[model samples]
Target: MIEFSEVSIAYQGTPVLREVSLHIGEGELALAVGRTGSGKSTLLGAVNGLVPHFTGGRLVGRVTVAGRDTRTHRPRELAATVGVVGQDPVAGFVTDSVEEELAYGMEQLGVTAAAMRKRVEETMDLLGIAELRDRPLRALSGGQQQRVAIGAVLAAGPRVLVLDEPTSALDPGAAEEVLAAVTRLVHDLGITVLIAEHRLERVLQYADRVLTVHDGRVSAAEPAQAMRSAPIAPPVVALGRLAGWDPLPLSVRDARRRAPELRAELPGAPVPAPIEPGAETLTCRDVVVRYGGTVAVREVSLSVAAGETVALMGRNGSGKSSLLWALQGSGPRHSGAVTIRGTDPAGRKPVPRRMLAALVPQSPADLLYLQTVGEELATDRAGEILDELAPGIDPDSHPRDLSEGQRLALALAVQLAAEPAVLLLDEPTRGLDYPGKHRLTALVRAFPGAVLIATHDVEFAAETCDRAVVLADGEVVADGPTADVVTSSPLFAPQVAKILGGGWLTVGQVAGALR
Candidate 1:
């Protein structure tokens, strides 16, 4: 249903994709895998003519979707044949309620009122979102919002559906909900699906084919074959490689079945030297946050010591973000006492509060606005910090022009330069690859102050954080050492822990003992 013939695309005189010839059959779920900023989005954009038509790039070859050449057809012209969903579902929303948002797409295509109503209901039912029809779009959970976004496009009855980073912001259970819906579309409806995701563990099992894009080249293979040498891989694949298993396993269950001999080789998951947390640097008491009638955060009390890192984790709507915002002192807090070294940051001025605690938000654009990376890091020895975190970034390049991973690094540099007593990061691994994540882990470990990370990435948390705190219904549910909290729960455990069934939470830990 989709074909690319010797397609070469360039933006600003730099080649993004070169000589890419591929075909995706109807009803096939094809996954595109690559490191950060490796032209994965460019390939997806070319499907419906977003690459050259809207991005103003040079296209040297032809891309045809459902036998319609993208050269002559713009996105609007091809809307009937193709539906595209972006990384942020909230950014693409045009209506306030779920039902209205679903119908808006059909209205633009001039679909009849009767057919629009029929398809809207059908799409919601198919996505298992029938109960959310009246919910406001902003109030929905991350997974629910993603489903509404998918249902909105599916109502148009397009032959091809494309998703970019569909579950980057969702927790484990929520990510499963979104992927389950996508797999149904391919199996029950025979819709051609093309998805680009950094979290391969969530989508690899559902994919029929995998397209590995690296350095402007695209190679097609089955999931098992593609993961053998893919540049970026999930923790399961890394464990398989470390053990020298023939034919890498894609899922935790498969890996566990093949891991008996390897298990015998290791003593119980090795225990590392305990880190001594310093005196308390951050403390919160009876924190309460509300959004009108809904209570987002309950009376939560927590404390973080100097030279310590804590992971704040929960479901998509379980008040993880709300708690982080309240502690930052800039967001809403109906009642709370947040102190850093005996100083109430909430009572200080904006500049003073920033000095007391620095927050690196989930979205990179929220932190970077200056024209160049050099100007943004022109204070507090941030250039030295960036050199240690991610070296060789062009100082003069536009902050917005950098790749997702590089932009995150630039933002981290800006925050680390402040030398605050407390540091908070929300979803820091959204666009980072394995190497980028390791770099971040190293930086977090070496910092002298306290750190709290609000994230959904279990593996990254295991690698970086010494403690884990879980929230449910806007209240703390689980709090303990990272290994104990993650390994004790199936939903929150990392791949290695799931496979080995012990204190192991990352491939690095297993590799260190086994190798």
Candidate 2:
């Protein structure tokens, strides 16, 4: 259904992908993997003619989708044949309400009104977003927006589906549902799906074939062979490699079957050393954030002392973001008292408030307005901090040209430049790799100020956070140590925790403790 023949893509004379020739059969689900800025997105964008066409790049060869050449047919011309859902769902939204967004694609294709309405309802039901039909697009959580984005394309009945980090923003359960829906489309409906994702642990098991984009070349192989030498890998695969297993395990269930013999080497459930937080503090009491009739955040009260890293854990729309924004003093706060070091940020100017408490929202792009990486990190110590957070990024590269992880690192560096008293990060791990995440943990761990991270990446929470807080329906449900909170919930538990089963939250913890 999709074919790339001698394809070489370059931007401004700099090659991104070189001589890539591959064919994906009808109904096959092919997963594309690579390091940040290694041409994974560029390759995926080429599937529907977004690379050289809309992106203003040079293409040397042909990209055919459903027998139509992408070199001649642009993204708009191939929209009905190839549906592309990018990393940022909100950026692609053209309609206000969820129902309209679902039907807008079909309307453009001139589908009959009766068929459009039926497809819209079917898609809403398929993705479990029926209740959000009338809700405005802007009000939906990042995960909700992602689902709507997929539904919008699915409603159009496209033959080929291209998803760029489809579940980056989704909660675990929601991710499973969405993936299940996609797999069903591939199996039951015979629709081809191509997914480019950094979070391989979520989709590897579901993929039939794996395509690794490395050093300007695309290597296609089975999941096992592809992961053998892949630069980035999930914790389970890392653990399998660490243990010298014959065939690497991709899923938790598979890892657990082989974990018993390995568990004997490590004799203890890790007891993390308690951190000594500083005296400076950030406290939010009775924080309530409401959007029209929706009470996004209830009367939630939380506190973070200086030198502390707290993970705000919850499902999508669980008020994790609402609480972060409220504490930042920019997002809506109907009634709340947020103070950092005895100073209320609500009364301060935007610039002054940033100095008090800086927030990197879910969409880190919102914090980035600069043209290049160098300009974004022009402030004192900003470039140094970025090197610490994520190294090897080119300062001359445009912010748009950077991968999701690279852009996120840039956005983080921009916020850290202010030297705020309290740092607020919402979904900070959306596009970070395992090594990059390690660097991020080191950076957050060494930061002198208090930090609150609103995230769904439990593995990251295990590594970086000193404490964890869970929110449900905009109210605090549980607050405790990272190991305790993450291990107690199966959905939130990391792969290592599921495999080793003795509070083993990470491969580092297990490897360090082993005989």
Per-residue lDDT over 14-41 for candidate 2, one digit per residue giving the tens place of the 0 to 100 score:
8889999999999999999887768888
> Model 2 TM-score?
0.95
Predicted model with the maximum lDDT: 1
lDDT of 1: 0.90
TM-score for each model: 0.97, 0.95
Compared with the true structure, all predictions reach lDDT values of 0.90, 0.88
CA deviation > 4 Å runs, candidate 2: 114-118, 121-144
TM-score between model 1 and native: 0.97
